[model samples]
Target: MARGFRLIFATSLLLMLLGICNGSTIGICYGRNADDLPTPEKAVELIKNLNINSVRIYDSNIQVLKAFANTGIELMIGIPNSDLLPFSQFQTNADTWLKNNILPYYPATKITYITVGAEVTEAPTNVSAMVVPAMTNVYTALRKAGLHRKIKVSTTHSLGVLSRSYPPSAGAFNSRHAGFLKPLLEFLAEKQSPFLVNTYPYYAYRDSSSNVSLDYALFESSSEVIDPNTGLLYTNMLDAQIDSIYFALMGLNFKTIKIMVTETGWPSKGSPKETAATPENAQTYNTNLIRHVINNTGTPAKPGEELDVYIFSLFNENRKPGLDSERNWGLYYPDQTSVYNIDFSGKGTVDVNTGGNLTTVNGTSWCIASPTASEKDLRNGLDWACGSGNVDCSPIQPSQPCFQPDSLVSHASYAFNSYYQQNGATDIACSFGGTGVNERFQPQVLIVYS
Candidate 1:
């Protein structure tokens, strides 16, 4: 009888597992603070071409929503820091926002999440207290519109929320933040939403590069950092950073609530103070990160569970304030070119000689499109246009392909291939000849091709 019961339980669990596997989604943050950039329509085409299915914009720009229409990209739009005050005071404001910025674009644009305030609690300003209430109001508005189930509500937090994060097990929120954080966590758990976090190991390294192992922070081979309480070893800084959040959640008694890395990335360049921020290190960190995501490997605390992640900005925002690193977190430049090389599994390509649509080529289809292509090769193709020669086509070329050294497109191409190897595109093979081989043109901004 016990054996029969065990088998029944296993079957039920199997069905649940299948459901998650079939519907899991990956997203990217689309922070648009740059002055010179592509229009929303072109941006949508870029993302669609890359196969990125999800995006999180910092605000509800109508142009962006209109661009995403019928593209099937799952959007997560936000209420900016300045709007939180008015939103907290009036539920009507929330409702109006929905009617104005959301409802009009729904189903057609496919908005799946609405962040009330991104990293407000972690901000140095006094708006911290308004965050939770604003989120509540936003959730209420969504429920009123019958979008609660389709669109979850939450706010992103910075690592500044943590008071103690060393030894992993001892992670806890700053006592000052707990007043609002505790209740917010409760709301998230009840609503079945994830706790979003923006983590940057580059920040940690930049603060004190001498003490930190560059390889460790870059997600490369290193001595494991063990959690004092659990005695579990972590080989990568990302897992360690994530587990810190889990520990904090556990301390608040909301252990069951899922934690998502809404934003995590490395900068490609920086000033003297942020010297650790370099192109090579950025590639290493991101490459390892994508592989970690594909492998679905969890932290020491949750070994098998897949962690949801969204990389930082799609393009560098040159106009953003703060240190040099702030503008350098972009994976690509303003023109949709790559900043470094990294490969992502399930986003690579294979060449076939059979005549077929160019869009369906194994790796050509952007798995994460509507904004950024999910596969490394296609992303490399985009970068190749801008002359970011991060893609090393040396092996594939019959002779040395004349890459424009100063061209951003060349750098992007190299970065894409580098990203693939760093991520998990271990089995991908490049095709030299195919039906559309001649037509498969990389982006040529004239400097390289002309």
Candidate 2:
């Protein structure tokens, strides 16, 4: 066997043994906001290559459901915001959605959870107000279909749902959001599904890096952020963020619900103004995060419970809106190459598409493309998967040195560029050959190969 394959097989066996020993579950969000991702079938192939056991998608896309069938991977599918209004009002709508989108694929897809809405507290529209009722209705529908026991219903909320989160003990929900969040918390507790949060230390850092320690947010080793009331020291921002949610739940009179971080990541690239965005920082954040999970490190508040975190994305999303950083949180480029190597234990042989010019590594053939096209064009060109659409890896420095620590975004931005230059209007220059998305015009690259 090839050395790489042997390494992969050994690693895979070790991972499987460790998973069995640890019995921890990890979930990844499969957001499809961009257009350059692989088809569901190919996505399944990619996911299998990663050996991730659980995954979450924004919607019950039939193709995704079908693609994942019989794979033994657990899925958590979403009910979009638009459909919430109708589903909340009409049981029939919920029933039809389940019958059409869920029932047929069941037992085959191994779907375990259904997220009724995403961060409803942060959703722009009334999707927040309708979430509880929508969840209830959806739960009822699942029950009617005799699938409620197997599938749990829940909704994700943003950290914005909290009124104060500084001291883990003093955490409380916003008065305004309480009316909506209380009932939802009850439903989750009743169903025993986790309370999900999309926590971003980046936002806090960007809002006020002066007050927020870059070290704390970036998972750098440092003195803990002490929660005065509890007198606990928090070594990582992710734990503090989650404990804040837990404390918020306590304030609402529901303290037992499990809290899970549904999404969290560091952007590998960003606009000039986004100081913390960089490849090196991204690597540190993810690498530390993986180590944290592997060690089963919990927040100071929840010392024993294992944290289940899905990094923001598998690939940098080229088409997401807002700052240039918004689109660059992926761990890989569209061609299934590592953006910067971190251990994922993703080595396997599979059928390759011979139709296109492809790079055959193992049995998988990945397309080699640069993210030279505009974000819109990339989105249009690729099927809309969160990390699939834009930005290229082909132009990066020597592919052989996949794990070169310096070329990463965090090091490139913070260590290489001056503080003034980080926030300056100077167009980003490529130390390597490729372009990363920035504010003015974000370019995306999507290459699809079986």
Candidate 3:
């Protein structure tokens, strides 16, 4: 019995060590704006098969809530803009909403967040006024039910709320919207909920494609744009956009408030004149995005911080209003076929063929912190790899062979590569909580067998 207990303990410890290097956390937005969609149960099954563990819905659909019960998928449910006024004016309405939409589904459904209204700033003036109040009422109602700490209450906003975004360091909210935003920010800060924003770099690139390089927006840029004021170098547009929000928050004295991307994606197809919108671009954007987020590479302004992100959608909403791009942002089609291949786990390279087949890539690779990785993240990763992962650290120790010109980046590289090689050289193994890694082939290297 003593020997058996020791074996079990050893196995559990090994599993825990391997689990520390698990893949990134990513979520998808489930928008039901069209007919011909699958039932909620089918949707939930599809989500699980894709290995995604988080989901956001546009409204509190009871069908979805009940279907998702016991699935262990974290959800961020929404309250439609139309219900904002009533929910704000009366606490009873908020209480009734909880009883109907939340209380029955609590614990079973794993609902983690409640968004009062999505893009409330885009609504009318009177409607915008109700957003904060509705959020407060919902929060109060949750407290009344003893679930306030378990679930968070907040709202989502669009990048349109920013009056300026260029240079990133100078970002600020539009003065015209400040009246509504100030109170909203205060509420979110008080509740310790993230400031959710619907950010789409596709729209920004499309609007100013002449100025914004296509490679930059797609996260494939080799060149960088340097911000004059902060001396920060931006390699991708997404990071620049996120940092702009960070700067805006800092300007408002809410520097501690976290930001979560509630919606972001590229369309797989678009109408004529939308040349940049193609399957190749969509696949590239989302693939690189998965890699970036999974690597935990924070924005240039705030390195190493892990930001929660949700891909725009699960299925294309055929009836969604606006340009054709509006209806084509899904990762999968209505028939549950992948629009393009994507590896949400960030474990391996996935090639999306024109014929809808995905192929795995194998090659020589190196592991190291990303150029923009935060110093703090590197130190933490270093500690985990050498201390707990049991990777040999002598080479990076004082006066060791690889210790010449010793630095965090240099030492981390040695440890990261050691762990990567020990773990079958998989991409997921290279991710040290967003410190970052690059995998490439080195044809010049030679191998000899005895």
Q: Compare the candidates by lDDT and give the number of the best one.
A: 3
Sort order, TM-score high to low: 3, 1, 2
**Predictions ranked by lDDT, top down?**
3, 1, 2
Candidate 2 regions exceeding 4 Å error are 1-23, 345-450
What is the per-residue lDDT of model 1 for residues 316-416, given as tens digits with 9 covering 90 to 100?
A: 99899988888988878888888886554433122212243222222111111111323455544544522442332331222222232323223333333
- Model 1 has an lDDT value of 0.67
Taken over the whole model, the C-alpha lDDT of each candidate is 0.67, 0.65, 0.80
Off by over 4 Å in 3: 1-24, 124-126, 347-450
Better of 2 and 3 by lDDT: 3
Compare candidates 1 and 2 on lDDT and give the better one. 1
Index of the highest-TM-score prediction: 3
Candidate 1 — which residues are off by over 4 angstroms? Answer: 1-25, 346-450
lDDT of 3 by residue, 1-450 (tens): 676555543332221222212223579999999897899999999999987888999899899999999999999999999899899999999999899888988899999999999887787645888899999999999999999888989899899889999989999899988889989989988777889998888988999998898899999999999999988899999998999999999898786577889999899888898988998999999898888886555577755444678998899999998889989999888889999998887642322232532222334466766657889999999999887775646545564335533567767776786687666568888999988576574332121111
Q: Could you tell me which 10 consecutive residues in candidate 3 have the lowest summed lDDT?
A: 14-23
- The count of residue-pair clashes in candidate 1 stands at 45
What TM-score would candidate 3 get against the native? Answer: 0.74
